[model samples]
Target: MRITGIRATPVAVPYRSPEVWAFGRRRGQVSVLIEVDTDDGVTGLGEAAAYPSADIVLAVLRGLEPLVLGEDPFAVERLVRRIELVGTWHHVKATSPAIAAVEMACWDILGKVCGQPLVNLFGGRFRERVECFYYVARAEPDDVAAEARLATKAGFGTCYLKVGSDDPRTDIERVAALRDGAGPDARLRIDANEAWSPGTAVRLIRELERFDLELMEQPVSGRNLDEMAYVRGRVGVPILANEASWTRYDQLAVIKAGAADVLSVDNQMDGGLANLKRAAGLCEAAGLPVVKHSLGELGVALAAAVHVIASTPNFRYANQAYGALLADDVTSGFGGGLESYADGCMEVPSGPGLGVALDPDRVARYAELYRTEGASFSFGDPQALARAHALPKL
Candidate 1:
C-alpha cells in the first residue's frame, strides 16, 4: 500500500533515577514516536530515541516526508536507500534515529500485511524471549549495592553499572559494592562510555577484575582501535565495544582492528532493524557476540528490537534496556518498570507487526509531560555542564 501521512509525537518519560554516564546525566528518556499511515488504512508505529535532540529528529522526519509520502511501505529497503542516498542523510549519523523510525514503521506495516510477527518474518524465533540487563544508575556505593540486590532478587542474570567517575577509587568502591549485593552468580557489566585513557583503563581494569566483571564497556575512547587493543591486551576483563561499533562500517573496522571481545549494536544509531540484523551477522561472522545498546527507548522501540533479537542467534549476551530505570511507559504492559520483566527477560510479543500497541491515555500523559518540561529529561546534566570536567579525568 502507498504511504499516506506521518505523525510525530515527542514524549518525556520519567526515570526512577537519573541515568548517569561519563559525560552527562539525563533524568529521564525523551523519545519521538512516529506513526506512519498508509492509504490502504494500515498504520505502523515507530519510535526514535531523541538522540542528540528531539528538535533534530522532528526536523529529519519533516525532511524525509517528500521522499516517503508516496512510496510503498512494504518496500523498506528501497525506502531506506532513497532516504539515505537521495535524501542525503547518510553523512549525518545523528539523524539516523529519525530515518530508522520511518524504516521501522515500514517493517511494522510489512509484518501486519503478511499476518506474521516480525520475528517470524526476520527468521522465526531463534529465541522466544529476549534477556535484558538491569541498569543500576550510577550512585553512591551503598545505593549501587542496594540496586544490585534488588536486581538479583528480580532474577536478572546480569546487572549493568556505569563507571568512569572522576575519582578512580570511587568507581572501584562502587563496583565492589555491586558485587557484594549482586552476589557471586550475577554477571556484572560496567560501561565507562569512552571516559578512560588506555593506561588508566588497564590499571583500573586490573584493580576491578576482582569483582568478576562480565565485560568492560568502552573503557577507553572508541575512536582509537589501537588504544582499545592496547587496553584489551593488558586487562583481563573482556572489552565490549560501544561507540566504536555504531554502524556496520564501524563494526567492520573494529573487527579488523581486533579491538574488542564483543560488539554493541543499535538500530537507532544505524538506520533500521534490518541494519541491526546486518550488524549482528557481520559480528557473528567475525566470531564475536553482539549486545544491543540503547539510547534510552520506550516500549515501541524496545518491541521492534526484541523481534529482531529473538530471531537472531548471536545476541548471546543480555541486551541493554531501560526497564529498570523507566518509571512508566506509553505502551500497554510493556517496557515501563522492572515489573514488566520476568527473570530479567521480556517475552516477545506474539501479535503481528511490532506486536505492541500504544496506550493512548499514557501517551497523552507523557506527551503533556514533554510539553511542560522536556528539558529536564534531556542529555545535558546541569551540574556537569557547570563544571569544566576534562575527559580521561586523569
Candidate 2:
C-alpha cells in the first residue's frame, strides 16, 4: 500500500525523578509519536525521542514528509536512502530520530502486512527476551545507594550509574554507596559522558576498580580515538564506547582504533531499526559486543528496540532503557516503569508489527501534558544554564 499521510503528536511524560548527568538534567522524556497512514487503511506507529529538542524533531518530520509521501510503506531502505541522500539529511546526525521514526513506522506496516512480528522479520528471535539495565540517577550517596538497592531487589542484573560530577570525590562516594547497597553480585556500570580527561579517567577508574565495574562508558572524549585507546588500555574495567560510536561509520573507526571493548548502538542516533541491526552486525563481525543506547524513550520506541535486540545475539549486555526513570507511559502493558520489566528483562512482543499499541487516554493525557509543560521536560536545566560549566571537568 502507498502512504497517504503522516500525523505527528508530541508528548511529555514525567520522570519519577530528574535524570542528572554531567551535562544537564531533564525531568522527563519528550517524544514525537508518529502515525503513518496508508491508502489501503493500514496505519503504522512510530516514536522519536525528542533528542536535542522537540522542535528540531518536528521540523525534521515536516522536511521528511515531502520525500516520503506517495511512497510504498514497505520500502524502508529506499525511503531512508531518499531521506538521507536526496533530502540531504545524511550529514546531520541530529535529524536521525525523525528519519528513524519514519523507518520504524514502515517496519511496523511491513510486519502487519506480512502477519509477523518485527523480531521474526529481523532474524527470528535469537533470544526470547531482552535485558535492560536499571538506570540509577545521579543523586546523593544515600539516595544513590537506596536506588541501587531498589534495582537489585527488583532482580535487575545490571545497575547503570552516571558518574562525572563536578567533584570527583562525590562520584566516588556515590559509587561506593551503590556498591554497598547493591551488594557483591550486582553488575555496576558507570558512564562519564565524556567528562574526564585521559589522566583523570585512568586515576578514577583505577580507584573505582574496587567496586568491579561491568563497563566504563565514554570516560574520555569520543572524538579522540587515541585518547579512548589510551584510557581503555590503562583502565582495568572494560570500556563501552558511546559518543565515539553513534553510527556504523563511527563504530568502524572505534573498531579499527581498538578503542573499546564494547560499542553502544542507537537507532535514534544513526537512522532506524535496519541501521541498528546493521550496526550490531558490524560490531559482531569485529568480535565486539554491542549494547543498545537510549536517548530517553517511552514504550513505542522501547518495543521497537526490544524486537531487534531479541532477534540479535551479540546484544549480549543489558541495554539502556528509561523504565526506571519514567513515571508513566502512553502505551498499555509495556515499558514505562520498573514494574513492566520482570527481572530487568522486557519480553519481546509476540503480536504482528511492533506488537504494542498506544492507549488513547494515556496518549491524550500526556499530549496535554506536553502542550502545557513541555519546557520542563527538556534537557536544558535552568540551574545548569545559570552556572559556568565546561566539559572535561578536570
Candidate 3:
C-alpha cells in the first residue's frame, strides 16, 4: 500500500514530582508523538524526545513527510534511510526521536499487516516479561528512602537513584537512607547524568560502596571514554554508561577503553527499535549486560522500549523509568494500558505492533499543551540545552 500522510503531535505530561537533574527540579515532561498514515487505512504510532526543542523536531518531521508519502511502510530500512539518521547530512540529535518515532510507527504498520506482535516480529520472545526498576527522582533524603520502600513493596527488583547534588554530602546521606530503607536484597542503581569528573566519581563511588550499588551510571562525562575507564578501574561497583555512549560506535569506544562493565541503550538515542537490537547484538558480542534507558519518555516510547527489551537476548537487568513518572499517557488499548507495571516486571503487550493504541482524546489534550506551553527547554540543567546545540556538524 502507498503511504498517505504523517503527523507529529506534541505532548506535555506533568511529572508526578519535579524531575530533578543536576541541582534542581524540572517543570514537567514534554514529548512529540508521531503518527504515520497509509493509503490502506493502516496507521502506526511512535514518539520523539522533545526536550531542548520540540518545535524544531515537529517542523523537521513535517518537512520530511513528502519523502515518505508513496513508499511501502514495510520496507523498514529503506524508509529509515529515506530520513537522515547518521553522517554529516543527519540531524539525529534534535530529530532522532522524531525519526525514531516514525520508524517505530512503520514497524507497527508492518506488524499489524503481518498479524504479529512486535516481540514476535523481532525474533519471538526472549522473555515474555522484562524486569523493571522504580526511579526515585532527586528529592529529600528521607523522601528518596520512602519511595524506595514503596517500590520494594510493589516488588520492583531494583530502584534508580539519581545523584548530582551540588553538595556531595547530600548524595552520601541519601544513599544511606535508601539502602537502609530498601534492605539488603533490593538492588540500587544511581545515575549521575554526566555530572562529575573521574576523580570526583571515584571519590563518591568509593564512599557509597558500603551500600552496594547495582551500578553507578554515567558518573563522568560522556565525552571521554578514558575518564570513565579510569573511574571504573578505581571503583569496585559495576558501571553502566548512558549519556556518554549512543550508537555501536560509542559503545565500542567505551568497550575498547574498558570504560564500563555494562551498557545502557535507549531506543530514542540509538535511532529506533531496529538500531537498538543491533546495539544489543554489539553488547552480545562483547559479553556485556545491556539494559534499556528511559529518560523523560512518554507512554508510546516506553511501550516501544518494552517490545525491544522483550525481544533482546542480552538485556539482563531491571531496566528503565516509566509508569510512576508521567501523570497520564497519550495511548491506550494494549493488553493493559501502558501503566501496568507490577511486581518488578511488565509483561509485553500481547497485541499487534507496539501493542498500544493512541487515544485521540488524550492525544488532543497533550497536543494542546504543546501548542500553548511547549516552546522552550527546561530539563533542570540549562547546560544540557547548550550541549545539545553544540552537536557536531552532522
Candidate 4:
C-alpha cells in the first residue's frame, strides 16, 4: 500500500528521577512521536528522543513528507535512498531519526501485512530472552553500593556505574563498593562518557582493573582512534565504543585501529533497523559483539532493539537504561513490564511487527504536555511547502 500521510507530535516525559550520566543531569525527556498512515488503512508508530526540543524531528517529518507521500510503504530501501539524496548536500542531522521513524513504521506495516513478527521477518530468534543491565547513574560510593545491592536484589544480572564524576580515587572507591555490593555474580560495567583523556584513561583503567570490571565504555573520546587504540592496549578490560561507532564506516575504522573490543549500537544515532542490521553484520563478521546503547528511548525503540538483538547471531552483551525506567510509555502492547527480567535476562516480544501497540490516549496526554507552539511544518515557510509539493518526483 502507498503511504498517504505522515504526522509528528512533540512530547516531553518527566523522568522518574533525575538521570545524571556522564553527559549531564536530565530532568525530563524531550521526544517526538511519528505516525505513518498508508492507503490500506494501516498505521505505524515510532518515537524519537530529540533532547532540548523536537524541532529537528518536525523538520525531518516535513522534509520527508513530499518524498514519502504516495510511495509504497513496503519500499523501505527506496524511501531511505530518497531521504539520503535530499539530505546529502546539507548534511541534515534529522536524516537518521526521520528515516528511523519511517523504517519502524514500515516494519509495523510489514508485520501486519505478512502476519508475521518483526523478529521472524529479520531472520529468526537466536535467543529466547535478552539480557539487560541497569545504570546506577551518578551516586556516591555508599549510595552506589546501596543501588547496586538493590539491583542485585531486584534480580538484575548486570549493573553499570557512571564514572568520571571527579577524582579517579573516588571513582575507584565507588567501583570497589559496587563490586563488593554486587558480589561476584553480577556483571559490572563503567561508562566515562568520553570524560577521560588518553593518559587519564590508562591510569584509571589500570587502577580500576583490581575491581574486576567487565568493560569501560567510551573511556576516551571517539574522535581520536589512535588514542583509543593506545588506551585499549594499556587497559586489561574491554573498551566499548558508544558514540564513536555510528555507521559501517565508523565501525570499520574502530575495528581496523583496534580502538575497541566491543561496539555499542544506538538505533537512534545509527540510522534505523536496516542500518543497525548492516552494522551488526559487519560487527559479527569482525567477531565483535553488539550491545545496545541507551538514548533514553521508550518502549517502541526498546522493542525494536530487542528484536534486533534477538535476531543477531553474535550479540553477547546486554544493554543498560531500559525496562521500567520511563515513567510512562505508549508502546507497551508487546509485554511492557520489568517483571519480564529474570536471572538478568529479558524475553523478546513474540507478537507481530515490533509486537507493540501505541496508546492513543497516552499519546494525546504527552502531546498536550510537551507540545511546542510553532508552525507544524519545518520545511521552510508555507511558501516552501507549496513549492515542494509542486515539484515532480524523480
Candidate 5:
C-alpha cells in the first residue's frame, strides 16, 4: 500500500504523580501523536514522547512527511535509507523520539496490512503475557515505602524505584524503607539515571548491597563504558545500562566492554519496535538479558513496547512502563493499568497492530491542549524537584 498522508498532533499529557521524579518535575508530559494514512484507508497510530519539546518533534515530523508520502509502509529499510536522518538528526540520538513515532506508525500500518499482530512478525508469540514491575518514582522514604506496599498489595512481582540524589545516604534510607515495607518476597530495583560519579556510584552500590536489590541501573555515565565496567566489577549488584546505550553502536560498545550485566532497551529511543528487537537479539547473543524501560510514555507507546517485549526471546527482567501514571492516555486496550499485575504479570495484547486503538475523544482533547496550552511540564530544576527534608547519614 502506498502511503497517502501523514499527520502529527502535539499533546501535553498531565502526570498523575508529577511531583515524584526529579527528571519530571513538570506537572505534565509533552508528546506528539502520529497517524499515517494509506491509500486503502488503513490508518496507523503511534506516540512520540518528544524530546527537547513537542514543538520540535512536530517540526521534524512535518519536515520529514514529504519524504515518506507515497512510499511503501512495509519497505522499512528502504524508507529508512531514503530519508536518512542519521547524522543529521542523530538517528538514535537527539531526535529519536520524533523518528521513533513515525517509525512506529509505519510498523502499525505493516501489521494491519499483513493481517497479523506485530508480535507474529518476530516468529510468533513466546508467551501471552510479560512480567512487569510496579514503578515507584523518587520521593521521600516514607512515600517510597508506601508505594512499595501498594505494589506488593497489588501482587506485583517487583518494585522498581528511582534512586539517585545529591546525597548517597538518602538513597540508602529510601532503599531501606522500600525493603522493609515491601516485605522479603518482593524484588526491588533502583535506577540512578546517571546522577552519581563513578566513585560515588561504587560506594552507594556497596552500601545498598544489604537490601538485595535485583540490579542497579545506569549508576554512572554511559559515555564511559570502562568506568561502568569498573563499577560493575566492584559491586555485587547487576548493572543495567539505560541512557548509556541508545544506538547499535552504543549497545556494541557496552557489550564489548562488558560494562553491564543487563542491557536496557526502549523502543522509541532505539528506533522503534523492529530496532528494539534487533538490540535485544544482539544482547541475547552476548548472554545478557534485555529489559524494557519507560520514560513517561503514553498508552500507545506502552502498547508498542508490549508487542516487542512479547516477541523478544532473551528478555528476563520485568518491565516498568509508567503509562498508568499519566492522568490521560490515548487508549486503554492493554487490559489493566501499569500497576495492574495479575499474578505478578501483565497480559499481552492479542489484537492486531500494537493491540490498541487511539481514543478519539481523549486524543482530540489532548491535541487541543497541545495547541492551546503549550507543554505542561515544570521540568523545573532537578534540585528543586527533590524533597526539602533531608536524612542524616546512616
Candidate 6:
C-alpha cells in the first residue's frame, strides 16, 4: 500500500537518574516519534533520539515526504535511495536520527504487510533470545562495583563500564573494582567514549590488561583512523569501533586500515536496519564480529536490534545499555513488559511486526512535554538558529 502521510511528534521523558556519559549529563531523554500511514489502513510507528532539536524529523519529512507520499511503502530501498540523493555524501549525523525513524517505520509496515515478525522477515532466528550487557555510568569505584554486582545478579552476562571522565587512576580503579566484583565468569567491557588520546589509551589498556576485559570501545577519537589502527596494534585487548565506524563504507575503511577488532553498530546512528545489515555483512566478510551500540532507545528499536542480532550470523557480543535500565520506555511503561533475561539471554518478542505496541496515553503525556519546555530546535546561540534553518531539509 502507498504511504498516505507522515507525522512527527517530539517527546521528553525524564530519566530516573541523570544519564552521565563522557559527553555530558542528560536529565531527560528526548526523542521524535514518527508515524507513517498507508492507504491500506495500516500505520507504522518509529522513534529516534532527538538531539539538539527536532530538526532531523523535519528534515526527513521535508525530504522524503514528497517522494513517499504516493509511493508504495514496501519499496523501502527506492525510498532510501531517493532520500540519499538529497542527503549529504557522508552520513549527516544530524539527520541520521530522522532517517532511522522513517526506516524503522517502513520496516514495521513491511512486517505487517507480510504477516510476519521483523526477525522472520530478515531470514529466521538463529537464536530465540539475545544476551545483554548493563550500562553503568562513570561513578566511584565502590559505586561501580555495587552496580556491577546488581547487573550480574539481575541476570546480565556482561557489564559495560563508562570510562574517560578524569583521573586515569580513578578510571583504572573503577575498572579493577568492576572486574573484581564481576569475578571470573561475567564479561566486563569498557567504553572510553573517545575521551582518551592514543597514548593514554595505550597506557590504560596496558594497566587493565590483567582484568580480562571483553573489549575496549572507542578508546580514542573516531576521526583519526590511522591513530586508531596504531592503538589497535599497540594494545593487547580487542578494540571495538563504536562511533569510529558505522556504515559498511566506514567499516570498509576501518578494515582496510586494520583499525579495530570489533564493530559496534547502532541502528539509530547507522541509518537503521538496512545499513546495519550491510555493516554486519561486511564485518562477517572481514572476520570481525558485530555488537550493538546503545542509544537509550525504546522497545521498537530494541526489537529491531534483536531481530538483526538474531538473524545476523556474525554478531557475537551482547549489546549494552538496554532492557530494564531505560526508565520511560513506551512499551514497558504501559503494559508490555520486557522479555526476561535468564542466565544471560533475553527472549525476542514473539508477536508480529516489531512485537510491541505504543501506549497512546503515554505518548500524549510526553508529546505535551516536547511541545513545551523540552523542545530544543537549535544548539548554538541566536545566530546559529538562522544557519540551521538555512541548511537543506533532510
Q: For residues 1-394, write the lDDT of model 2, one tens digit per residue.
A: 8998999999999999899989788889999999999999988999999988899999999999999999998888899999999988995899999999999999999999999999999999899989999999899999999999999999999999999988899999999998998999999999999999999999999999999999999999999999999998987999999999999999999999999999999999999999999999999999999999999999999999999999999999999999878999999989798889989999999989999999999999999999999998887776677766877887
**Model 2 alpha-carbon drift over 4 Å, by segment:** none
Tell me the RMSD of model 2 versus the true structure. Answer: 0.8
Model 2 local distance difference test score: 0.94
For 322-357, candidate 5 gives per-residue lDDT tens digits of 644556676755523554447667677667777788
Model 6: per-residue Cα lDDT over 204-302, one tens digit each: 898898999889998887878897998999989999998778666778888898899998877777777878888888889899998878666666667
Query: How close is each model in CA RMSD to the real structure?
Result: 0.8, 0.8, 3.9, 8.6, 3.3, 5.4
lDDT of 2 at 39: 96
Residue 27 of model 5 has an lDDT of: 69
Question: Could you give me the TM-score of model 5 versus the true structure?
Answer: 0.92
Model 4, C-alpha of 71: deviation from truth (Å):
0.9
CA lDDT, every model vs. true structure: 0.94, 0.94, 0.78, 0.74, 0.77, 0.75
- Model 3, which residues run further than 4 Å from truth? 85-91, 333-339, 375-377, 381-394
Q: Against the true structure, candidate 5 has what lDDT?
A: 0.77
Q: By summed lDDT, which 10 consecutive residues of candidate 3 come out lowest?
A: 385-394
Error of 2 at 266 (Å): 0.4
Against the true structure, what is each candidate's TM-score? 0.99, 0.99, 0.92, 0.89, 0.92, 0.89
lDDT of 1 at 72: 97
lDDT of 1 by residue, 1-394 (tens): 8999999999999999888987788899999999999999999999999988999999999999999999999889999999989988894789999999999999999999998999998999999899999999999999999999999999999999999887899999999999999999999999998888888899999999999999999998889999999998898899999999999999999999999999999999998999999999999999999999999999999999999999999999999999779999999999899889999999999899999899999999999999999988887776787766776764
Selected candidate, larger TM-score, 1 vs 3 = 1
TM-score head-to-head 3 vs 4, winner: 3
Cα deviation in Å at residue 258, candidate 5?
A: 1.1
Please give the distance, in angstroms, between residue 265's alpha carbon in candidate 2 and its true position after superposition: 0.3
Candidate 1 shows a clash count of: 0
What's the lDDT for candidate 3?
A: 0.78
